[model samples]
Target: MGIKIGCCGFPVSRKKYYGEFNVVELQNTFYDLPSIDWAENLRSEAPGDFEFTIKAWQVITHPASSPTWKKMRRKPRGDTSNYGFLKPSNENLEALRETVRVAEALKSKIIVLQTPPSLPYSRESVEWVREFFSKASDIAQGFILGWEPRGEWSKARELYDIIEEFGIVHIVDPFRATPHLGKGGVVYFRLHGIGGSEVNYRYKYTDDDLKRLHEIVSKYSVDREVYVLFNNVYMFDDAARFKRLINS
Candidate 1:
């Protein structure tokens, strides 16, 4: 009925997070996927009204060279050259399927595919994204697909076009830029914080910042679902403050 706010991951205990917020954008799914049984257990442990939105596996969006891969519990294997940047390679497609399997286990309605920040946009790169999503669509049925294209393509028309063409939600850091909603009219904000790249994780939202965020997300809430998931270091406290500010 209104803007759904939460942290990107559990900033506190799951029980506390679930009690305080109605939705969460799962970040662990990006680093390492939980086994289906684990995902099901996690889901069963949450409150009945809790909602989950998954961040697609890093193998599909980031290359083996990506530092993010170092956090994986199971090391990557095989010819990983084709992995990441949505290359539509066998490795990436397989990763997509695995992500979908976990999403299904969690009963997640949204599956977000985020491109690596180092990805450079080009004609070939654009085609690769298209090809990946094209293959991904088959496995993405019954879920709201989201794309967070970073670097040069973050706010480009090509990203918008892909979203429109494939009916995907645009995942944006609303503090940096406005999201260009496509046919579905869904708004998903990943609030990294208000600052330069270095300041993102450390920065905290002020009262004015929360007021502006509330104003921006409110515009689209009347028509479609709008999500605001905080990803900063102070996400737990910040999100709680935001909820109180808006509800008060």
Candidate 2:
């Protein structure tokens, strides 16, 4: 298995992060996009092998009421109704376009759409997301799209169909649920700790947990590249540890 290990964000300074790890998931893009010049500069600053994977802009996945907007470097200027929960509307599509522009600047290969539980597994939600993926795919050429569906969608039967139809990588926490295979050719895992079904950002992963994680990962017989990103309070340390374990 080709496992790329890193933190969800630059848990340390960008320079230090680039020195220690080759991959990072950009949470900043979800909150607000960095200037194109800045993203381009960072791309130049890093090693050529370094990779950036983005968390899609919140306007593409979140409602205005979401607390995630509180950290925005800037706020939305127009009606917020069409935004969030994969509405597949003009505003949301525009939001995705902006996200792709930033991703393009960063040389990003993956743009992840993490949806809310409110848009549970249903014929209507699946159709809406299918259309959203359809339009998003058109905008993001030569880039892999990852969808992390929350709540009931995690174990829902409808999950497999859309992923196959769109060639989307099914992003998940391996501890929470086995990721459904897709045509996207990547197994992406975002670790939020052993909180059962919910995210426990405060939890620190133990050595035994890491062992089990390695074991859990080995169960996958697929030949796809695997991305293991730690997103907890101790992400920096935990990610380093997991990287070492995998390499050993």
Candidate 3:
């Protein structure tokens, strides 16, 4: 298939996955920003040859309005509404920009905004996302913006259109197969596994499934760049599997 396949992170440390793939999705950004010094500490820990595609912190998208968020809120009793725990807003937009700046400083390839499962496929949310990306794109000039919708809403063309319209990429997690097939800038995937409520959504990629994936990649593998990320963190066993598939 002559494609670049990788995983979310280097199983335990960046040193382990180096030379395995050119890219790794540093997903910690999806949690919360630890500390400027600590973030830099992580950056220093990683090897120089690797490129990182980080996920946006959940705080910006899934703010602290709820009891759960209220506890995780960066600032206690801090106008949770501004950050968009319940929904996106100006404050949330600002937060997204700042995080993008941090990713930029780290020289990350892209920033992924994975919408929480609680988020429904609402027009308002879609519009809000569109507008936010319009603004985020400007700030993240060199880097791409990627979004992965969870659950059933993952397959909605309307949502896909929104992302495509903004020239943003899609993060295709195996847990939510949405049929995106990487139509956007760069097709991204996370191999969760093959069992659970969303088990059907999770693809184990057997030899047959690998053939289908290979065919899909072959069709678009030329010229355009693509990333296949394995989220099945059996200590980077999924990454090793991807390597064999592409090389074979």
Clashing pairs in 2: none
**Tens digit per residue, CA lDDT, model 3, 1-248:** 23567777667656667756677887666655545666676677667766778877667667564444544436523465566522446667667776776786677877877766666567767676667777777777877877776664566657667665777676664334633533444666666666765434334556666666667666656756667777653626656765787787
- Candidate 3, 65: how far from true, in Å? 6.2
- On residues 1-248, what C-alpha lDDT tens digit does candidate 2 reach at each position? 47788999888898889888999999988988778898899899989999999999898898888888788877766688878988889989888888888999999999999988766567887788789888877988799999898887777877788888878899988888788887666889999988755698988999999999998776662577889899999999999898888779
Q: Which stretches of candidate 2 lie over 4 Å from their true place?
A: 120-122
Off by over 4 Å in 3: 65-77, 85-88, 174-184, 199-208, 233-235
Q: What lDDT is obtained when candidate 3 is compared to the true structure?
A: 0.64
Models 1 onward score TM values of: 0.96, 0.94, 0.80
Worst 10 residues of 3 by lDDT: 174-183
Indicate which candidate wins on TM-score.
1
lDDT score of residue 104 within candidate 3: 64
Model 3 / residue 45 / CA error / Å: 4.3
Model 2: worst 10 consecutive residues (lDDT sum): 216-225
lDDT tens readout by residue for model 1, 7-35: 98899999888889999989899999889
